[model samples]
Target: MRCRYPPGMPFYAYILLCNDGSYYVGHTDDLDFRLGQHQAGALGGYTAKRLPVKLVWSESFPTRDEAFAAERRIKGWSRAKKEALIAGDWELVSRLARNRQGA
Candidate 1:
């Protein structure tokens, strides 16, 4: 969903599509700045090495804890699930989750 913040500072859980076709999940209060850091290699970590990462999806949360929790949960998701989320296909995401649980 689009990042819409409440009155106070907002937290965001975001997914980045890396150059190597991998996904990177993270949470931050300053989404634009954090994305800049990843793109510039200033973060010096996973996205740094991947270079030229593009933001695929992001959601805003009222609390940092909630955003962090979302990041952790998304990190555990399969690539297909992530793709479904990026495509705004909630039905596919739910289906994939159910199939994974059955597996």
Candidate 2:
């Protein structure tokens, strides 16, 4: 889902498509500022090394904990599952999950 805040401030779980075609999952309370940091290489970590990252997908949550949980969950996903999520293809994500379980 896109970033949608409810009434008060919202936390976000986000996916970044890196320059090297890799994916990075993270959570933050301020999406825009965090993105700016990543783009500017201020964070000095994974996204920094893979500079010029792009925000591919993000979802707003009511609480920081929820956003963090989503980030962790997405981080554990396979490339296909992550791509399915980016495409908003829940069915494909489910099928991929099932296939992984079966394997």
Q: Specify the highest-lDDT model's number.
A: 2
lDDT for 42 in candidate 2 is: 97
| Inter-residue clash pairs, candidate 1 | none
Model 1: per-residue Cα lDDT over 28-88, one tens digit each:
9999999999999998989888989999999999888999999999999999999999999
Using all chains and alpha carbons, the TM-scores for the candidates as numbered come to 0.91, 0.90
lDDT of 2 by residue, 8-64 (tens): 788999999999999999999999999999999999989999989999999999888
User: For model 2, what is the alpha-carbon lDDT of residue 83?
Assistant: 99
Worst 10 residues of 1 by lDDT: 1-10
| Model 2: CA > 4 A from native | 1-7
For residue 12, what is the lDDT in candidate 1?
Answer: 96
